[model samples]
Target: MQLVLEKRAERSGTIALVSPLLAIGLTIVTMVILFAILGKNPLLALHAYFIAPLTDGYSLQEIAVKATPLVMIAIGLSLCYLANAWNIGAEGQFLIGAVAGSWIAVRTQGTDAGAWVLPAMLVLAAAAGALYALIPAICKVKFGASEILTSLMLVYVADLFLDYLVRGPWRDPHGFNFPTTAEFDPVATVPLLIEGGRLHLGSIIALLVVAAAAILLARTIKGFEIRVVGAAPRAARFGGFNANQLIILTFAVSGALAGLAGIIEVAGPVGHLQPGISPGYGFTAIIVAFLGRLNPVGILIAGLFLALTFIGGEQAQIAMKIPLDVTKVFQGILLFYVLACDSLILYRFKLVSSNRQVPRGAG
Candidate 1:
C-alpha cells in the first residue's frame, strides 16, 4: 500500500508537467480526425487552420484582434482563480462595461473631450464591470450564495439588458432598423499601435496588465496572502487574512479587467456597440485561465494560442468549405483534453487483475 501510494504521488507530479503538452497534442489529433470526417485532406485543413494564419500580415493582425480581449479577461481571471474565488460573471461584467463605455462615448459626441474622453470611457467601463461583479461578491460574503450560479445567471441578464437597450432606447435612428448603436466618433476610438496594422494599443495594455499581475502574484504581500488563502484557508485565517476582503478584492479586480477588455473591444475593432459585440471572449477566457494553469504569463501565451484557433477556424470555413461549427468542436476537444490531463495530474489510473485468485488465496 505504501509503495502504491508513493508511485501514485510520483505519477501525479509527472502528469502535472506533461498535461499541457498532452492537451495540445490531443487537440491537434482531434482536429485531424475532424477534417478527415469532413471529407477534406487533413494536411490541407491543418495548413489552413495553423500555417495559413501565420503566412500573412492580415491574418496575424486578426489573431491579435481576437487575442486582445482574451488576454485582458484571462489576466483578471488568473487573479480570481489564485484567490480561489470563482467569478463566472465576466461575461455580464464585460457587457455592462461596453454599455457604460459606449454610453459615455455617445454622450460626449459633438464635444472636444479629446484624449480624455477615451480615458474616461475606459474608467467608466472598469467601474461598471467592477460594480456588476460586486453583486455576486456581496451576496457570497453576506448571504453565502454560490457565486458560480449567481455570476453565470447574471451573464444572461446582462445580455438581455443589452439587447433591450440596443433594440429600444439606444437604437440608432439611422441604422436602417438595425440592432446597434451609432458609429463611435473618432474621439471615442482606441488608437492603433501600428499605423498599417490592425493591432491596437489595447494589446499593450494587456501586456502591461500581465506584467503587473505577475509581479503582484510573485512579489507582493497581498499575493502571498492570496496564495495562502487558496492553499489553506484555515492557515490563512489563523494568519489574519481577511477572507471577505480577499473575495471582494478578487472580484473587483477581475471585473475591472474584463470591463477594460469589453470597452477596448468595442472602441477598437468593433467600433460601435452592437447587440452581440462579444464573440464569447468572457466565457472563453475562463478556459484560457485554466489552460494556462492560472498563471498570468501562461495565460498570455494560452490566449494567443486560442486566438489562433479562432483565426484558423475562420480560415478553414472559408478555404476548406468546412462549417463554422468545426471551430467549436476544436475548442470542445481542447477543453476535454485539458480537463482529462488535469485529472491525471492529480490522480493515477490502476489496472487490477480481472481473474480471481481463489487458488492463491486458498478460497
Candidate 2:
C-alpha cells in the first residue's frame, strides 16, 4: 500500500479563501488539547487568550501598537514572496534599520537638530535596510548562492552588531551600565495620534502601506511582472520580464519596509534603541503574511489578530500562570496547519495497492 498526493487540474478558489480560517480553527483545537495537558482549564485559557484582550481599552490600544510593525513588515514580505524572492532576514534588516536610524538619534541626543532629523532617520533606515537586503540578492544573482540561507545567517550578524553597539559605544555614559542608548529627542520621535495614548503615527503609516500595496498588486504592471515571475517563471521570461531584476527590486522594497517598521518601533514606542526592541515582530510577520493570504487587507486583519495573541500571552502568564512559550507553540501549530491546509487546494491524497509480484522476496 502507498499514499501519494495527486495534483488537481485546477485549484479551488473556495478552498483558497477558507484555508486560513481552517488553519485557525485547527490551531485553536490543538491549543485546547495543549492546555488540558498542562492541567489548565481549557475554556478559561481560551477566554483569556481571545476575549480578555478585546474587552479592555488599554489592551485594545496596545494591540494596535503591536500590529503597526507586524503589518508594515508583513506588507514588504508579501511582495518578496510574490516575486519568488526568499528573504528570511527581515529581522536583521529591522535591526539594521533601528541601528542606522539611532545613529542620528544618538548623535543629536542633546543637540538641537531641526525637524529634518526624524525624516533623515527614516530615510537612512530605509536605505540601510535596502542595502543590507541587496547583499543576499546580489549574492544569489551573481554567485548562485541560496538567498534563504544567506539572508537567515545574516540575521545573527546584524543581531550581534546591534548588541555590540548598545553595549559599547552607543551606551548612555551618564546612566547605569545598561545596554541601551539615551532616550531620543522630541524632534526624532514619532508623533502620537492621541494625547497620552500609545496610538501613534506609525499606525497611520501602516494603513497607508496596506493601501499602497493593494494598489501595487492590483493596478501596476510591475506587480503583474512580480506575479508572473513567481507563478510561471519561464512564461514570464518569454513575456520579456527579467527575473533577476525583479528579485533585486522586491528584496530592496521588502527590506525598506521592514527597516521603516524597525525605526518606527524604536521612535514611536520605545523612545530608545535597545537589545530587545523587537519581541520577534520580524519573525511573527511571517505568520501575518501567510494568514492574510499575502493580501494587504488580509494582512491588516491578520496582524491585528496576531497582536491580540501577544497581549493574550501576557495576560495568560499573569492570570493563569501559563508559560509564555505556549504562544509560540500556538504560532508554530498555526503555521503547520496553514501549510497543510493549503496543500488541499491543489492536491488530493490517494491510496494505492501494488501487485504481489512487488513483494516476491517476502514470498
Candidate 3:
C-alpha cells in the first residue's frame, strides 16, 4: 500500500510538470485528425497552420503585431489571476479604452500636438479601462454580485455603445458614411520601430511590461500579498490583507494594461477606430495567460505562440482552403485538453484489486 501510494504521488508530480506539454501535443494530434476528416492531408495542413508563417520576415513582423495586444492583456490578467480576482470584462475594458483613446485622437486631428498626443491618448485609454473595470469589481465587493456574469454582459453593452457613437455623433463626415472615425494624424500614431517595417513601439512596451510584471510578482510586497490572498483568503485576512482593496487594485491594474493594449492596437496597426476594431484579442489573452501558467515570462512565450497561430491560420485559409472556423476549433481543443490535463495534477485514478477482501465482509 505504501509503495503504491508513493508511486501515485510521483506520477502525479510528473503529470503536473508535463500537463502543458501533453495538452499541446494532444492539440496537434486532434488538429491532424480534424484535417483528415475534412479531406486535407493532415501533415500538410499542420505545416501550413504552424510552420509556414515563421519562414519569412514579413510574417515574423506580423506575429509581433498580433502578439502585442495579447501580451499586454495577458500581463494584466496574470496579476488578476494571481490575486484571485476574476475580471472577465477585459473585452469591455479594451473597447472602452479604444473609444477613450480615439476620442482624444479625433479631437486633436487638426492640431500640431505631435508626440504628446499619442502619450495622452494612451493615458486616457488606460484610465478609461480601469474606470470601466472598477464597476464590476465594486459591484462584486459591495453587493455580492457574480462578477463573471456581470463582466461578460458588460462587453456587449460597451461594444454596442461604441457602435452607437461611431454611427452617430463620432461619425466622420468625410468618411462617406463609413462607420469609422477619421484617419488619425500621423503624429498621433505609434511610431514604427524598424524602417520599412510594420513593427511598432507597442512590442517594446509589451516586453517592458512583461519584465516589470516579473519583477513585481517575484520581488514586491504586494505580490506576496496577492499570492497569499489567492492561495488562502482566510490566511490573508489573518495577516491583515484587505480583500476589498486587493480586489480593486487587481481589477484596476488588469484593466489598465488591457486598455493600454487597446490604445496601442488602434494607434499602431488598425490606425483608426472602426466598428469592429478588435478581433477578440481580449478573449484570446485569457488563453494565453492560462497557457503561460499565469506567469509573466511564461505569458510572453505563450502570446507569441498564439500569435503565430493567428497568422498561420490566416495563411492556411488563403493557401490551403481551410475554413477560418478551423482556427477557433483548434484553440478550443487546446484549451479543453490543457484543462483536462491539469486535472490529473490533483486527482488520480485507481484500479481496484479484485482479489482483495472487502472490509464490509469482516465488519
Candidate 4:
C-alpha cells in the first residue's frame, strides 16, 4: 500500500478553525495509551496533568506567571512566522537578553541605584536580544545561509556562554559554590502583583505585548506587508513588499520580545542569573506560536494552556513518579500532532495499492 497526501480542491474553513482542537484531542488519546503501557492509571495521569493545576488559586497564579514568558516569546515568533522568517533560535535570544539585562543588575549589585536600574536592564536586554537575533538574519540575507541551522547552532553558543558566566566570573561568592550570580537586588526586581503571590508585573507586560501585536497586525501597513510576503510571495513582490527586509524586521522584533521575556523571567521569579535560566522556553514557544495559529489573542490562550502542562507535569512527577522528561516528550508529541492535523487542512492522505500497474499511454 502507498499513502499519498492529495491536495484538497478547496480549503475547509471549519477544519482550519478546528485543527488545533483535533490535534489536542488526538494527543490526549495517545497519552492515554502511553499511560497504560507504563502501568499507570490514565485517568489519574490526566487529572494530574489537566485538573490538578487548576484546583487552587496559587497554582492558577503560578500558571499566569509561567505563561508570561511563553506568551511574550510566542508573540514575537508569530510575527517572524507570519513574515516567512523562521527564527528557531529564540532560546538563544532569550539567554542573550537575560545575560545583557543581568549585566546591569550585576554591576549595580550593592549600589544605591535609583529607580532607573530596572528600566535600564529591560531596555538593554531587548536591545541585546535584537542584535543577537540579527546575526542569523544578516547571514541569511548576505550569503543565503540557512537561517534554521544558523539560528539553531547559535542556541548552544548562547547556552555555553551563559554557563561559563554563571560558573566562573559571575559565581556567587557565598552561594555555597553554586553556579549563579547573586540574587538581583530588590530595586532591580519585577514587582509582585499581589503582596506575596507568585504573579508579578511580567504577566501585565505580556498582556500589553499581546495588545500591541494585535494592533500592529490589524491596523498597520507593515502588518499587511508581512502577511502578504508570507502568504503570497509573488504578489508581495508585485505590490512592492520587500521579503528580505521583512525577514530582518520580523527577526529583530521576535528577538526583542524573547529578550524582554528573558529579563522579566530573571527579575521576577528566579531573581538571579543562573546556568539553567530557561526550561526550553524558546523552543516551546514555537509550539505555542503554531498552536495559536500565529494570532496574538490565540497565542495568549495557547501560552496559558502550555503553561498548565509545565505545572501539571511537575505535579505528576511528584505524585506518580513520572519522569520530568515525560513533559518534553508530551510537548514533542503535541507539536507533531498539531502539524499533522494542520496538514490535513490543505491536503489529505490517500492510499493506493502498490501492485497497481501504470496505464498505457499515460505519458
Candidate 5:
C-alpha cells in the first residue's frame, strides 16, 4: 500500500480556526516531555514559560517592546504570502534597513539636526528595504530564478555588510572597541510613550501598521487581486491580474515594512546601530506570520504570544537554570507542529494499492 496526502474537497471552517490553537497545544505537550528529560519539573517549567512573564508590569512592557518589530515584520510577510511571493530574506532586509537609517543618525550625530532627521531615517530605511527586496523579485521575473533561494541567499550578504559597517566605518570611537555606532541624537530617536518606561512610539506605530494592513486586506481592490493571485492563478489571469506585478509589489511592500521595523528597533529600543540589532526578529516573524494564519489581526496576536516566549525564556534561564536555546527549540517545535496541523486540516491521508496496470505506451 502507498500512503498519500490528498487535498480535501472542502476544508472545515471550524478546523481552520482551531488549527493554530491545536498546534500550540501539541507544542506545549512536546516541551513538557523535553523538560522532563532535562531533569526539570515540567509543571514548574510550563509556569515559568507562560505564566510568570505576564505577572509584572515591566515584563508586560518588554513584551510589547519585543512585539513591535515582530508584528510589523510579520504583517509584511503576510502580504508576500497572500500574493504567492516567497520572500525568505526579510532578515537581510531588516539589517539593511537598520543600516540605511543609521547612516542618517551616524552622520547627524552631535549636530544640530532638527526634527527632520528621524523622519528622514525612516523614509530612507523603508526605501532602501523596498529596493533591496526588488532585487530578488526582478530576478525572479526576468531570469526565472527561484525567489526562495535568491532571497534566502541575500540574507548572508546583508549580514556581512552590516558587520563590516559596524566594525569598520561606523564604529563608535568612544565605545571601548564595541562594534556599534554611537547613540542616536535625541532628534533621531523614537520618543518614549511614558516617562521612564520601556514602551515607545514604535509600539504605537506597530499598532498603526496592523490597522492599516487590516484596511488594505479587507477594503481595497489591491487586496482582492492579491487573494485572487494566490488562491487561483488561472482565475487571476482571466480577471486581468498580472501575477508578476503582484509578486514585485508584495515583495517591495514586505521589504519596506521590515525596514521600518528595523529602524524603529534601533532608534527606539536599541538606541544605536549594531551587528546584532535583531535577535532573529526577521526569522522569528515568519513563525508569527504563519501562526497568525497570514491575517493582520492574527499576526498581532501571534507576535505578542511569541514575544512572551522571549521574556519567559530569559526568566527560565535565570530562575531555573534552563538553557536559553530552549526558547528557540520551543519556537521551532511550534512552527513544525503548526505546519503539520495545517496540513492535516487541508488534506487527508489515503492508502491505496501500489500495483496498478500501466496504460499502453505509458512508461
Candidate 6:
C-alpha cells in the first residue's frame, strides 16, 4: 500500500477559507480531551475558556485591549507573508520599539515635554522597529542567510537587552529596587478612549491599521506586487519585480508595525517600559496572520478571537486551576492544524494499493 499527496491543478479557495475554522474546531476538541485527562469537567472548562470571557463589560474591554497589538502586528506580518518574505523576528522589533520609545519617555520624565512627546515616541519606535527588522532582511539579501533563523534568534537578544535596561540603566531608583522604569508621564502615554476605561487610542489605531491594510491590499499597485511576488515568483520576476527589494520593503513594513504595537502596549496598558511588557504578542500575531488567511479584515477578526483566548486562559487558571501553559499548548496545536489544513488547499491525499509480487510468480 502506498499513500501520496498530489498537487491539484488549481488551488481550492474553499479550503483556504475553511482551514482556520477547521483548525479552531480541532483545537477545541483537543482541549476538551485535555481537560478530561486533567480530571476537570470538560464542559465547564470550555465554558470558562470561551463563554465566560464575553459575559461582562470588563472582560470585553480587556479583550479589545489585548487585540489591539495582535491586530496591529498581524497586519504588518500579513504584508511580509504576502510578499514571500518571512519576518519571524517581529518579537525583537517589538522590544526594540518599546526600548526606543521609552528612551524619550525616560528623558522627558518630570519635564513638561508637551503633547509632542507621545507622537515622537511612536515615530521613534516605528523607525527603530524598521531598522531592527532590516537587519535580517539585509543579511538575507546580501549574504544568503536564512531569515527564519536570524529573526528568531534576535528575539532572545532583544529580550536580554530589555532585561538589562530595566535592571540597570532604566531602573526606577525609588521603585523599591524593582527592575522597571518609572511610569510614563501623561504626555508620553496613550490617551484612553473612555475616562477610566481600558479602551484607549491604541484600539482606534489598530482599527485604522486594519482599514488602511484592507485598502492597500485591495487597491494599490504595491499591494499587487506583493501578491504577485508571493504567489508566482517567476512571473513577478518576468514582470520586472525585484524579489530582494520586495523582501526588504516587506520586512521593514512588518518591523515598523511590530514596533508601533510594542510602544502602544507600553504607553497604553503597561504604563512603563518593563521586561515583561508583552505576553508574546509578537509571536501570537503569527497565528493571527495565518488564522486570518493573511487578509487584513480577516486579521482583525482573528485578533479578537485570539485575544479571547488570552482572557479565557486567565479565567480558566483561576476558576478551574488549569495551568497557564495550556494556552500556549492550545495555540501550538491550533497552528499545527492550521498549517496541516492549508495543505489541502494545494494538494489531496490518496491511498494506492500495491500489487503483491507473488501474484506475478504464482497466482
Per-model tally of clashing residue pairs: 0, 0, 0, 0, 0, 0
Off by over 4 Å in 3: 1-16, 353-363
3 or 5, greater by TM-score: 5
Off by over 4 Å in 4: 1-4, 349-363
lDDT per residue for candidate 1 within 1-363, as digits (tens), equals: 121211354446667778888999999998888788889999999898889999999989889889989988988887888888999889899999999999988787668777788999999999999999999999999999999999999999999998998898888889999999888889899999788789998988999999999999999999998888987899999999998899999999999999999999999998989878987889889889888888888888889999998999889889878887787777778878898888776666665555545455555
TM-score of each: 0.93, 0.96, 0.93, 0.96, 0.95, 0.96
Candidate 1: segments with Cα more than 4 A from true spot: 1-7, 10-14, 354-363
The worst-scoring run of ten residues by lDDT in candidate 3 lies at 1-10
Off by over 4 Å in 5: 1-6, 349-363
Better of 3 and 4 by TM-score: 4
What's the CA error at residue 316 for candidate 6, in Å? 0.4
lDDT of 1: 0.88
Per-residue lDDT tens digits of candidate 5, residues 1-363? 889889999986887899999999999999999999999999999999899999999999999999999999999999999989999899999999999999999999999989999999999999999998999999999999999999999999999999999999999999999999998999999999989999999999899999999999999999999999999999999999999999999999999999999999999999998888898999999999999999999999999999999999999999999999999999999999989988977898999888877578856
Q: Residue 218's C-alpha lDDT in candidate 2?
A: 95
Q: Which model, 2 or 5, shows the larger TM-score?
A: 2
* Residue 253, candidate 1: alpha-carbon lDDT: 92
lDDT of 3 by residue, 1-363 (tens): 221211244447678678888999999999999999999999988889889989999999999999999999988988888888888888889999999998989998888777789999999999999999888989989998987888889899989999998899888889999998888899889999998898999999999999999998899999889889997999999999988888899899989998889888989998988877887888888888888878898899889998999998999999889998898888778878888887777666566556676577554
Candidate 6, clashing residue pairs?
A: none
> Relative to the true structure, how large is the alpha-carbon lDDT of every model?
0.88, 0.93, 0.88, 0.94, 0.94, 0.94
How high is the lDDT of residue 105 in model 5?
A: 97
- Candidate 1 or 4, higher lDDT? 4
Candidate 2 residue-wise lDDT at 282: 84
Instruction: Give the per-residue lDDT digits (tens) of candidate 4, residues 225-284.
Output: 999999999999999998999999999999999999999999999999998889999999
Off by over 4 Å in 6: 1-3, 356-363
Number of clashing residue pairs, candidate 1 = 0
Best of the two (2, 3) by TM-score: 2
